[model samples]
Target: MERRRSFPDVLAGVVFILIGGAFVAGSLGYELGTPLRMGPGAFPLLVGAVVAALGLAIVVKGLVAGEVIAFGPIPWRAVGVIVLALVFFGFTVRGLGFVPASLVTALLTTVASKRVRPLMAVAVAAGLTLAATLIFVVGLQLRLPLWGPWLGF
Candidate 1:
């Protein structure tokens, strides 16, 4: 079988490599100590080198093996809905409280999926709220209100 270059992987590898380079560059501003007592720059620089290496590997693979990925259509609605849900969560978390904010966000994101029914969304939201409350509030003991000022709590 004839091998072809993988353009998508190459692109992703390049992006990762660039991001790693940025991390390394940014970390350079901070003082990096020795291996025994590593500084802020140490981690970032190491991550950057790893990213660059991975990118280089991908580029090499693309050059040697012919593997191409066809770009699929983007899911605009789902992306928009998830992003909107996060924005909503950010705005309402303090006011509405953790449970409500999580519920709303989970519900919105779930509903964004075409396969999810209204009842299913509510169920998922409720489950998410319960789990979040138990894990964050009861388990981890985060200093966040369950219900906010609106509920007179």
Candidate 2:
């Protein structure tokens, strides 16, 4: 026997549809004029349409399939770590510089991942931070400081 749609699933579908509709309506008011070509509204309008379609599909699928979607338990620890890391980034990025901020953020996020060991996670985070710095800062010629002025970089 097929399972029936639960209240939560129905609510989620309705919420998504409402949000998508709002985005579409908001995008319509954005001026669609530019000298070169398509204006700022074009991309948002496309995104809104896609969101609306996906929301509609979700609603239709839930109704037809009649299956209750079960979400797993929330990972509170991971959420906390991510939020803290973001705060740390915001506070430290300008003063401590990109490399350190990136490392700290990456390490926190990696540690939050369920599968990672502390040592391996640290190593991966360091590697990723270095790679990101090289790509986004050096290669892209972005003006981010490699190290703080106190460290004299």
Candidate topping TM-score: 1
Cα displacement (angstroms), candidate 2, residue 123, comes to 0.7
Per-prediction tally of clashes: 6, 0
TM-scores for every candidate against the unseen true structure:
0.65, 0.56
C-alpha RMSD by candidate, in order? 4.1, 5.7
lDDT of 1 by residue, 88-138 (tens): 999989998998899989999997788888998899899988998999999
Supply candidate 1's per-residue lDDT for 80: 94
Worst 10 residues of 2 by lDDT: 1-10
Residue 94, candidate 1: Cα error in Å is 2.9
Model 2 clash tally, residue pairs: 0
